[model samples]
Target: MAQTADDAKYLWQKKLDNGHIRIGFNDVAHQEIGEISFAKFPDNLTEVKLGDVILSIEGAKAVSEVHTPVAGKVAKVNVALKDHPEYLESSDEDKNWVVELF
Candidate 1:
């Protein structure tokens, strides 16, 4: 596991067994965004570069944009969030992950 941001407030990276990379948010990010109300993600984006906004999470406190940490093709998204947005606050770090980049 790897983390960006001095505070580790949001971003994390992990290399999978297949040598692909995955990036997502940590628990602290959810705290910063407060209670999650909604989330939006691009439907047809198969590739992304570092700093690309892959997702946007809206919460009671504010709307937070989730960026890619490295250039890669998107492998999957946590579709569960579409119905259970509250998981951003209630789920563990692994479960709260918004997307998987590979």
Candidate 2:
């Protein structure tokens, strides 16, 4: 499916000042799954291959894996969900960046 302004299929990829690219799922991902409850990222420093399982999210009904479009080192993880997992509901991408690669 093509990514439209109303639908977010392709993640918004941006290069950070550090040279690593930051990526987050688009709104379509949230809309398809409904209110996301759980977001799981691969362990830090773990190598993730393209199309590999980067993160699996549990929505209202189904569980889906968020794929990694690129290959790199997992530099950081968003721990905000530990307290407010629902953040993924309000702000799907910015607050829900599953992991950052280095």
Cα lDDT over the full model 2: 0.64
Evaluate all candidate structures by whole-model CA lDDT and list the values in order: 0.71, 0.64
Q: Cα lDDT for residue 75, model 1?
A: 84
lDDT, candidate 1, 1-102, per-residue tens? 212233245767778788777666667776676788887787786899877777777878776677776778888878887887887676475667766777
Best by lDDT: 1
- Clashing pairs in model 2, backbone N/Cα/C closer than 3 A: none
Please provide, for model 2 over 1-77, each residue's C-alpha lDDT reduced to its tens digit, 9 standing for 90 to 100: 21122213635666888987776766666667777677666565367776666666777755776677878877776
Displacement of residue 87 (Cα, Å) in model 1 is: 1.8
Please give each candidate's TM-score.
0.80, 0.75
